[model samples]
Every structure is written in C-alpha cells, then in structure tokens.
Target chain A: MEWRWDFTIEILPRMLSAMLNTLLAAGIGYTIALVVGLIFLLGQRTKFRLCNWIVRECVEFIRSTPLIVQLFFVYFVAPQFGLVLSAWVSAMLTIGLHYGTYLSEVYRGGLEAIPRGQWEACRALNLSPARTYFRVLIPQALPASLPGMGNYLVGIFKDTPMLSTIGVVELMHTANALGAETYRYLEPYTMVGFMFLIISLPTAAWLRKFERYVGRSMGITK
Target chain B: MSTQNHPLELPEGSPLVRFSGVTKRYGDLTVLDNLDLDVGAHEMVSVIGPSGSGKTTVLRMLMTLEKIDEGVIYVDGKPLSHMERNGQLEFANEKYLRTQRTNIGMVFQQFNLFPHMTALENCIEAPINVLGMKRDEAEERALNLLDMVGMLEKKDQHPTRLSGGQQQRVAIARALAMRPKVMLLDEVTSALDPEVIGEVLNVIRALNSEHKLTMLMVTHQMGFAREISDRVCFFYEGKIAEQGTPDQIFNDPQNERTKQFLSAVLDAN
Candidate 1:
C-alpha cells in the first residue's frame, strides 16, 4: 500500500490530541514514580529487618516482572478484587510502580556513591537526621542520580505505548484506531513513530543539559 | 523507641569524658578491649601509636561514631553510648545520644567539608539549625571564626575550590561554631601535603594555647604532639602502654613496649 500524505494530514489533529494524552500519561506517571521511588528508597534505608526485607522483595518483584503484565493485572484482575480503576489510572499506577523500582535503585546507587566521610561529617556537625538527608546529603546525591533518573524518564515515556492494550487513548492507541478505520496501517503507525522521535530526541538532549547544570550548581565539575 | 536515661549526669566534678571498661569488636577481632581512659576539664591529651592500635577508635567512640560493645562512655557527666535502664545500662536512646553529641565536635583526617556549601555556609549551618541560633548571629560568629582560622577571605569558596590545608582550617572553624566542650582531632594533618602540614598544625597550636578547649588527638606527628600535648599516651594493641607529661613519656619512658615503639617511630622520622 502506498503512503498517503492526505490521509496523514486528515488524521493529524486526532494524532496531536493523542500525543497530548501520551505526554500527560508520561508526565503524571513520572511524577508518581518520582515520589513513589523516594518512598521505596526510604523503605530500603530503614533499619527494621522485616520492613526492609519486604520492601526489597517488592522492588525486586516489580523490576523483574514485565510492565505489560502489570498493566494487564491492574486493568483486568484488579477489578475482580473490587478495585475497578479506569484504564488510564491502571496504566499510570503500573508504570509508576514498575519504573519506581528502577528509580529506587538509582537513588540507592547515588546514595552509596557518597563517601562514608559525609555521614561521619554530618554526625560530627551534629546535624539532625532530617537536616542531614535534606540539606547535606540529597544535594550531593542529585548529581550522581541525575543520569539514571533521566534514563528512566525516557524509559517511562517509551513504555507508555503498553497502555494501549488496556484501551487508553494515547498515541499508539490512536494510531491503531486510525489504521483500523481507514484500512491503512502505514501512515498512522509511521506518524506515531516520528512523533515519538521528535519528542524523545529533544528530551534526551535537555536532560543532558539539566544534568550538567545540576552538577555545576553542586560544585561537581565534569 | 525506648524510654531514655542519663545515669552519668552526676553534678559533682566528674571527668569531661570517660570510657569505662569499653570494648569494641569487629566480628572476632577486638579493636578496643576493656579500654579505660579519662579526660579532665580543659585538658589537651594526644594519643600516639602505630596503625591499628585503636587510637582513632578511642576518639571515634567519644564522638559517638562507634558503638561500644561492652561498656559505657560518659561525656559532660552523662551517658554517651548507653543510657541507664532500670539499674542496668543499654545502648543509648536517640534523645540521650543527641544530648551528648552536642558537647563534642571532631575534625577529620580528610577534612570532610560539605562540598556543595561555601566555607561560610559550612560554619553557620550547625549553629543556625542544630543550635537554633538566629541567622545574623550565626553568620557573625561564623565570620569571626573564619577570621581566627585565617580563612576569612576564602569564606565564600566551596570546599572543592580550597586547598587541603585551607579546607582543614575551615573545618576547624566549622567545628568551633558548635561550641563543643570536647574536640577530637583524628590525624587532622595526616592527609595534607607535607608543605601544608605546618599551616594546619599552627591553627591547632593556636587552638591549644589560646583556647581552654579540652582536646584529644590521635597523631603520628610525634614532634608536634611532644611540643603541644599536655599529656601524651602511648597506645599498644588497644590499651595505653604508658601515659604521663611529655617529658616523662618522651624522655623517661618506663614501659619496654613504649620504649621500643618510640624508638622505631623516632628513628623513622
């Protein structure tokens, strides 16, 4: 089948709206993942043996399982258990939890990269626990954490297509619908691929700049 | 989450810091074994020993950096590592630990200044946040301390921008901002370049002669310790082998181990 420029132009508005939905899904999911990642990171840091073990196991389980399976379970099986969330809600929760485990590992790696001397220094200064983590430690952790966090941000954006199987009207879902209705698969699928490229490329570049700025502000050259 | 106690907080004339029958073990290797030591009010004592002799562990325990496996540490007449629990001592609660930690400050071998903060920020953070001092007051006192350490001009520089000696001076100023009654110097000059050791030693010398601070240091610089320490203790295998005024410990050593260690150390220098 020949590629149809006219058909592509005709469906451009719908695809644009679907692009917005994709961004919204990625944005909201990333926000949830950022917060949930911190919660998971704190869980890993706690001293309670059972709690630490439980949280560690949970993170491992999430990271090991496929995101699509989690999406299916959240969208399909959860309703049987009486938690009947919308497709968007289920997808967001699954993506947040799945990527959140990855992000927690990033945070753990960043924290471990800090020298033991920093902790001893905080003890020596007699800084409170809250002050030590927030003011002193986290600022240093950010420079080390930014690259991994940026990687997962892009990872989550790419994985938003998995939401389509659960029937959320994001870019890929919109493209599939357009293809089925017009009996033409090429233009819609190709447009979707180009749109993702247009967005992801600039985001990766911007994240690099952001990482450098964060490092510079934290007195970490290179 | 346990109720706390301060059994060592007796009112009458207790030592400023004491480790009573303290023991530290790492797996099966004992680091500090049944250690007993005392620092009186406003005294300067230097601990000298070869590596792994537990000189650094002594200061680290007093600073509450290391846990005591078998005994109690007293600071400012109160329990430091343990609290009295129904007539028995247990690992201290956080409230007790924090209360004791405020009485002590430490300088590290690596001069671990907060790299993200300027020297002035490093000095004032504890004063304003931990001590709840007003910002202007904290800044004022921080500046004076920077000036005293001869780091006043570089107060705005981050630690990464400073030389090792300059950073150590700033670290000293930072510790002084806490107003700690006891200061621990754990090989403070050991990490510096040989040329810059004199600058850091000069700051410490001024701190010893000019301030009434109770200072305990673990040092390899035998000459500096002999010159500045009021009392010198030679440690061997986690215990003090000999202790006395500098003249007695250095010139008239009695313990054979002390003699051997000093001769080996002095010959190396």
Candidate 2:
C-alpha cells in the first residue's frame, strides 16, 4: 500500500532487462504483422473469389474476437492438435496475426484514399502493374498509412503484457514474479506503469514527427 | 469479347486511330452507342457536346480507360481492347493491353499529376519506369517538354504548389514525355480558372502547330476548338450528330442538334 524506494531500486535491474524482452517482442511482432498485413491485402485483392472470401472472413473473424482468447487458442489449443509451439513462437504468431488484421485495414484505407485518376494516369502512361503499385501507389499510400501504422505500433507495445499469459517472461511477467516473491506489489507494478508511460509518450511524439517528415519528403505536403 | 474470323478490315489509307462500331454501356445506359470514328496521323480532332453526350467517353475508350461492350478500337491499326489469337478475335489480356497502351497518352480534366512528384519528376517518371530510358535521357526529354509547356521555371514544384493551369501544363508535358503516337485530352481545360484557361489553350495551340501531335480533344471551348481543330465533331445521344472541317461546323453548321448546341454554347458566351 505504501511506496518503497529501496525495493524499487533492488528490482530495477531485473525490470530493465525484462523491458528489453518486451521491446524485442514488440519489434518482431510488428514486423511480422506488417508483412502479414500485406499478404492479407493481396489475398483480398486476388482474382479468385473463393480465396478473397476466405481471407476476408479470416480477417473479420480474427478482428471480431478478443485478442486474449486468440492468444489462448494459439498457445493452448495448437498443442492438442500435435502442432506444439514454444511460448515465444506462439506469442509472436498470435500477436502478429491479431494485429495484422488491423494493419491490413489501415493499408486498405490508405490505398483507397488515392484518387482514381492516379491509376488512370499510370495506365495511360503504360506503367506495368508492379511499377504502378510499388512506385506510385505505395509511396502515396505510405503517408496516409503512417498515422494508423504508428498507432498500432504503440498498441502492440501496450499489448505486450498479453504475452506474459503465455509465459514469454517479458516486462509484465517480471513484474508479477517480483511482486509474488517479495510480497510487495506496489513498487513493482508502479515501476512497470512508469516504465510504459516513459517509453510510450516519447514514441507517440516521435511518430508524429516521422509522419510529417514522410509527407514532406514525398512532396504530398509543403 | 467479339470473335471475328477475318482480320480487322481497316479503311483505305488507314487512320492512326479507328473506333469501329464501338459500344459502351453502363448498366441500362449506353454511353457510347455503335460509334465509328477516326483520327489520321498528325490530325487534331475536337469533340464538343453537353455533358452525358459521350464526348469524354470517346477519349476514355481510345485511352483504354473504359472497355467497350461491343466492337473494337484500333490504335496504330491494331485492336486495342481485343487481340487476334489463332486468327480469331478475343478480349485482350493485360499483357497485350500494356504493350499496346504505350502508343497512347492522355491529359485529364483534373490534371492527375502525381502529387508526390515535382513537375519534372512527373514528366520523367513514365519514361524512366515504363519506357526503360536511362535516367539522364529521361530527364533531358522531360526538361525539354517542361520548357515547351512553359513550366520549366516551376519544374521543381509539386502539383499542390502549382496553380491549376500550371498543373495541367505539367500534365501535358508528362504525357508528351512518353512520346506517344496519339494524345487524348479529356477536357483538359475544364478544371482551370478563367484567366489560366488561356495559358493552357495557348500551350495546346503551340502543340498543334509546332509538334503536329495526333490529338483527340474533348472540350467546351467552342472558339478555341473552332480555331485549331482539323475536324470538329458534335456529339449527341452517344453519337456524332455532325462532323466537318472547323469552318463548316462552326460557321456553316448543318445538323439541327449542332445548330442548337453551337447557338446555346455561343449564346452563353
């Protein structure tokens, strides 16, 4: 119930080390999500109706359900089907997939924001589909996508605590262990909150600056 | 898709672009109905009509931006929307469209210059990326085109920073950088301010006289069209009501629709 500086100082090293795992998990998870989101977008864009339908429904299903339930299913249920995965792998896969659906929507919105005339211009100029998408469309989409993508970066970082449920031994897991061992929850939990606040605040500010920089570099904004 | 056993029968001394019985429908509305038209090499044809009269659709179809429900569009005397396979015509595939679309370029009403690029970059993008030209060559060609359009001073400016007319000039230069055999101008001046309209029209005039570029323009500028067009087409109800030399179409008009349209348009001025 009372604040304790001594205990906080005693647990600082373990907390800092655990924060590294948390950062690593978020970084790897976000990378996977970014790539997975593109694949999902492609799936929805493919010519095959069945494939589009299946990917669309999968995106919806994943999005409609809770992330913790999904984490449980991937961590607990897969082993039952003789597809056992380690805690780190299962946590990474679950986080990637859960957030990927959201990122795909972000990408779709970014793409749709482009004027139809741009595509027409590309076609009239006879640029190949690959060039149009990669060179023209993606650069334009990136500025539009950056804000949403940045939000999810923070979102995934906050969600790293969910990885603790699967025994990934990240920040939240360390906090819980320290609290149980010392029978003093206040310092450990408070330190965890401060740590998250410390990182998230600066990240959000930096992301805004980054978004503007991207827009300016692309000549989309003056 | 239309299956023709025989090869396309082009007219005598075939035109650079031929729209042969091309039909386009949007649900129940036929936007272009059984249309037949031609543009000879170095010819400038101006199409004028009220909105929904399918004037823009002509340019759109020639640019392969819209697919015809029936018939074929020939560019450089080859089918644009369809291909001949095994001596039979079938709907053209994407690969075929890519190869054939290189011969054409278009300037849009809204300019459609890539906002992410500067005027020079916009002009050079297609030449470098699509035509596989070396960067220096593409830049040189783009610089020359930007100069021709009177946008050389603003070549480093983005489309957003430029005025509407300047953006349009950049768009024109962008199209010409491809060195297209035919240029489609779909009301390219419609989006400009009244004062800026003259600058764009002046650019087009120079293009007509100096470059002699084969052009198909859909426009509302009756006077400008009358002055420069080698042939003027008056469209009504998805067909050309009348077409003739600018002198005949503007000064000694024939068709009732043409008379009504010209008078209504001229009266507004």
TM-score of structure candidate 1: 0.96
Which candidate number maximizes DockQ? 2
**CA RMSD of all predictions:** 2.5, 1.5
True contacts kept of each: 0.67, 0.86
Candidate 1, residues A40-157, lDDT tens digits: the string is 9889877688998999999999989999989999999999999999998898898889998999899889988999999999998888888988898888998899999999999889
Chain A TM per candidate, in order of listing = 0.98, 0.98
* Top-TM-score structure, candidate number: 2
**Maximum-lDDT candidate:** 2
Cα RMSD over interface residues, candidate 2: 0.9
User: Which tens-of-lDDT digit does each residue in B1-269 have in candidate 1?
Assistant: 22233354546698888877788889998888888888998899999988899999998888888887876788877778887767766788777788779999999999989999999999999999889999999999999999999999999898988999999999999999999999999999999999999999999999988896899999999999999988999988988888999999999999999999999989988
| Candidate 1: segments with Cα more than 4 A from true spot | B1-11
Q: Supply candidate 1's per-residue lDDT for A102.
A: 91
Per residue, candidate 2 scores C-alpha lDDT tens digits across B147-174 of 9989999999988899999999999999
